[model samples]
Target chain A: MSFSPLIVRLMETLRCLPGVGPKSAQRMAMHLLERDREGALALAETLQAAMEGVGRCKRCRTLTETELCAICSSHTRDQRLLCVVETPADVLAIEQAGSYRGYYFVLMGHLSPIDGIGPNDIGAPELLRLLDEIEAEEVILATNPTVEGEATAHYLADQVRRRGLKVSRIAHGVPLGGELEYVDGGTLAHAFAGRREVTA
Target chain B: MSFSPLIVRLMETLRCLPGVGPKSAQRMAMHLLERDREGALALAETLQAAMEGVGRCKRCRTLTETELCAICSSHTRDQRLLCVVETPADVLAIEQAGSYRGYYFVLMGHLSPIDGIGPNDIGAPELLRLLDEIEAEEVILATNPTVEGEATAHYLADQVRRRGLKVSRIAHGVPLGGELEYVDGGTLAHAFAGRREVTA
Candidate 1:
């Protein structure tokens, strides 16, 4: 008749995920009890482990087991080519591509002054301070293609330029194999404006 | 960079959730490591507990911690009246209504000979035996409005009739306040078929 408070709390906690509502949470909870018991346990254990010990990498602000992340600890990674991103999820997305061997700087958020988010909120101030600490010759702004993403990229570019460092923003617009007719006008324009000649 | 097999395996395991893909699985895995460690551990504990001990009640076949379900065990419930359903989730739905005080008989599934499931697959035989043991006075069939649900209800009605017991199926068709003109053909037919005699 009654679920233990702990069970209800776990279901409530799961609702924090994107697109999950009460019905989905209930289904997920029932599923955990019915089918994926081991997986549920593993998730719980992982959460516990991360919450108690995990913290942001002091250098790049990526979620890490230690103060410094694996990228920062590794000597083989291309430290001179630093890729900056909005969140940890963004870092994972870039990593999935498996082409960029550069180290990373995770901002965790972006500048949104209207929503009360500022440079400090997204760790921009801290990132600027880290630039002097790390000898990265080039920085890539790999923020999303949204207006907020563009503004943040431009702001970062200006700050890095003032610091006398080379700053480049990741190309945004129409994707490869995309039809111009189907593409959003804004993205197409950005793509054309940022177009570069193909190199052999 | 390549993730350790343990990490990848955990991510794969977590991806079994309905909407969780590989990327969401990775984020969730990472989240488990970053936050709510104790809660995660508690979830694992509950999973193990449910997996180890929870099972169907001998009476209604609904999930229970004991041989008898909570609904069956409750002395306050109307034992003389029984509600038949296709799944335990249906039982939960009725319970949440707070109007249905009768005991339940969960079919667990409906007849699907093509999928290899039959009458016995969903504890129909067990239900048959339990009906005699309980000596219930009235049985209300509350299966879904689907073809399988209807077929299952008919099968139950036939089985109960042979024993000379009172059995009735729940009404099918358009929802409350639904426009007849807007209703689907199948629903309209069912609504017509289940229509009760009106006194003029």
Candidate 2:
């Protein structure tokens, strides 16, 4: 029902994006071909360049154009404190917070046996290989607070504790500026359980 | 706060699409780079090919890879009944209805004086020239019901009527399956005013 095959292909290709649905894909195709062809061309070029060039950082599994990611290459970063997270996006999120100075180990996904995802599927073997090379004092479990994420964290903790390394989970608590009444029950319980002594 | 310049550029370029914000752009970039590199490459190729190859049909201004659009070139379509719409997306919508065998003249935009978009800006001159070549019996205005659309339709009607060609506007009414209570006042009024005699 599209105007042309190229147009239809463009629309279909756009639907591969994370959240773009059929309607939004149609709108995007129309808008690009009509008003922003130059921008669209730029997007295409950049997309191709990135897809061909970017690869996982050998050390941390974060996406990079080179063998190692910026954090992994930087000598100033704390090599002893490795942050374990589920994806490269978490690495970016932590970087934006401007607090963490450690290297990262990106799992890319959590252990999901039902979906056929195992420890090796999410780069746990790679992480283990790197851990053997680097003298790490502590490993931070920064995976998401989902059921699968918790399971992954427990598994990683078990593996890391076998090497006698310190393990710490990023605290689950009420978000800053969040109202207590509106917080979900699970999060509220986690916040209550993980409460620390009030400081002056 | 991203990993690499190319990745950042890809994310920024993706934001050019309508309704895509920073967060979604980030997610799209991550998803494409991490999970679907081949699909991302295909999308890039399709986008580039489409942007380069697709152009306005010489006859009716719809997008095409060739000189004439499919509808305009089709002998079965009612060439004498030309439908004017604000965008190629509208043409697709009409085509999807499985009705409207008439050709289309895509305006691409409407008159928006505040934004400096006028008659000429939206290819009014080209439309006028096409009108002279085609022996069209009627020109159907299917522009949106917005203020700008109404003004554009009125202006087009005035211009088309001077050629002694019949000009008709598509009816504005409560949408199919929309409740009367939820429908806007102006649309309800238009629906009431344009009411027709009941048929058996």
Candidate 3:
């Protein structure tokens, strides 16, 4: 009635990807099998290598093959400014934005009490210890704009303040090129509350 | 300036999938490396097993680990009615529809002169030989509703007719749930020309 066992298994496994459902999984499986077997093989090898070799960076907790991730290990990056983010994807996003020469600390997740995630679980304690050990003068809270992200950022700010370090949250405002009419109420309110003088 | 070499390589390799652009490929790579490492390992193993083991079924040219695909080897399926199609995805689509019970002959492609595809490339000679060797009573041309598909169907129909075999094309018409207003003119004309009398 359906595909052979291996084909069915492959399709099911492909659904593990983010935003992929059954139909998309089927399409991807067929495409890999039909057009790019060599690419599929290479992907499989890369996945294996990444899984078996990659682990959390000792300093920042981001994924890397070595003890420290590329960002954490680089000597040229500014160690005085630390950007705290919720996941590796956020690190990549900030990197792609073509700004920010500071170092990063990947929390890997935010505080979700319902999901049993606490400070220690997301490496918050390790982050505190690393902040104490490092010469970081400022910490930037760059978690996503969500309830849990806000909670995590507040918690981190309190902890960093206790350690006598300057803590600043990333500015919440309308995105660049965004029209005020289309901006959500929460963002509009934040923009109004955090208004700065037009010194320029 | 970017992700580590391994991460970069993984992201590049993931772009081989259809519809997966650079951003999506990066997302997939980060997801595999960060959250679901175990799932990624399993996917890698599965991909390897599938690529190294799965091959075309000798009888119908559909993908299978064995000499014959499930449909080709199954005795319960009606071998008398053969459905010809382009690609294994078409076979899966028809199977999901749950109406067809006949066996299939997967051509893997349509005849496209512009791209240099010919009858031999689609295994038409093998199909003709199989038709002669089997007890097939009717052949169904189920290629897509494209110009190349129509040409391939006409060619196959002529070949089958020369062997004194009956051939019928899958009907072209407005889909069962589609509105006539949205239906294209070519399909509307085909529906009108292929009109049948209602006996009721």
Candidate 4:
């Protein structure tokens, strides 16, 4: 009786993604039916699979299908060179660069005082535990250049300095107010390769 | 174990909507969770319910929960004045304008020649059959101003004239290249009320 029950149900489910509104949801539903039903279905499957399968690595908070992330579990990666980021999306952004063989540690969020989100809310304690567990020679701050991201980086740098481990920040290839995802992969790779040590 | 599976899936669906891209989808998905999860959920439920419930009216191509659409079956509506449109969404847009008290006949699509769509493909035959079923003084063409929409209207008008029925086109209040859905409700309502008869 229904023209498109599965398609409609899928659109309803997709309305849960961050920026989608009702009108947008309707257009998306129509597009799914009209143009790219396969891609829509793929996206749906990815969502369900990611929801069911993807989890944070126990060691570094990177997205993983298992106990540890692929980067963290890989023996080929440099355990000594650890990069820190604000989210899993940022981790993916970095991975696209494809030059750095260093592992990453995701903060999962940044410190935002106005929003009442602090280090405790973003797994800073767990980060410290991760740092202690790994034999890292240098920790790179790959958080964004936003105010909250900067504060998170500063806070993280101070913590690692107290632990007597060498700390570094990613070079300023990223704009002050820009997001990591929007940046070109080559620029991000170059920034990673040209990171500067933060000794104080 | 997951913080937001529904939200992630919904964002994916939002991507298929008209204006939403990846970044916007992310923002929308986050907004739903952060600002109003219940409202978002209500919207989702409505989408599912409407998808499952709404069907083509047997009498008109307008969407209905029953065999006959509300306009077709309603005793209060003017049966003598029937309006024709291209899609179910167009029907909703016209209804929201609050001017037309007449019945509707939705074609579900316009005639697209290059894409191989024709009069028979988009329910034109069904509409021709409905002409005999309903006793109407005039049938107003409310299809969009697009070339394909124009062609379809012309085709329908010719068919209605052959049967010795009065056929008229909705006036050109909207821009030449504009869509009915994008026009303001008041403008569309006024246009419907002030509709003039087709000369050619």
Q: Tens-digit lDDT track for model 3 on B86-109? A: 878777766765667788999888
TM-score per candidate: 0.72, 0.86, 0.85, 0.83
Instruction: Give the runs in model 2 whose Cα sits over 4 Å from its true position.
Output: A174-200, B174-200
What are the lDDT figures for the candidates, one per model?
0.66, 0.79, 0.79, 0.73
* Local accuracy of candidate 4 as per-residue lDDT tens digits, B15-56: 655677777766665455434555555555544555556566
Q: Candidate 3's residue-wise lDDT over A96-122, tens digit each?
A: 554577899989888999999999988
Number of the candidate with higher DockQ, 2 or 4: 2
* List of chain A TM-scores, every candidate: 0.77, 0.85, 0.83, 0.83
Q: Which 10 residues in a row give candidate 2 chain A its minimum summed lDDT?
A: A191-200
- TM-score of the second chain for every model: 0.82, 0.84, 0.85, 0.81
Worst 10 contiguous positions by lDDT, candidate 4 chain B: B1-10
State, as a TM-score between 0 and 1, how close model 1 is to the true structure: 0.72
lDDT of 1 by residue, A39-157 (tens): 77666554444455567788888776676777778888887878778766566555655556778888776789999988888888887888888888877787776778778888888
lDDT of 2 by residue, A1-200 (tens): 56698999999999999888887888899889988999999999999999989988888888889898888888998878888888877777666656677888998888999999999899888888888889888888777777788789888988887877787776667464442223455664464345332211
1 or 4, greater by TM-score: 4
Q: Choose the strongest candidate by DockQ.
A: 2
iRMSD of prediction 4? 7.6
- Taking the tens digit of each residue's C-alpha lDDT, what string does model 1 give over B1-200? 43433445656766656778876777666555444455456555555565556677778877666777767788998777788877666666556545567788987677887889788887777877878888687777777766777677778778876766777665555565432223444554464346332211
i-RMS, each model, one decimal: 4.1, 1.3, 1.4, 7.6
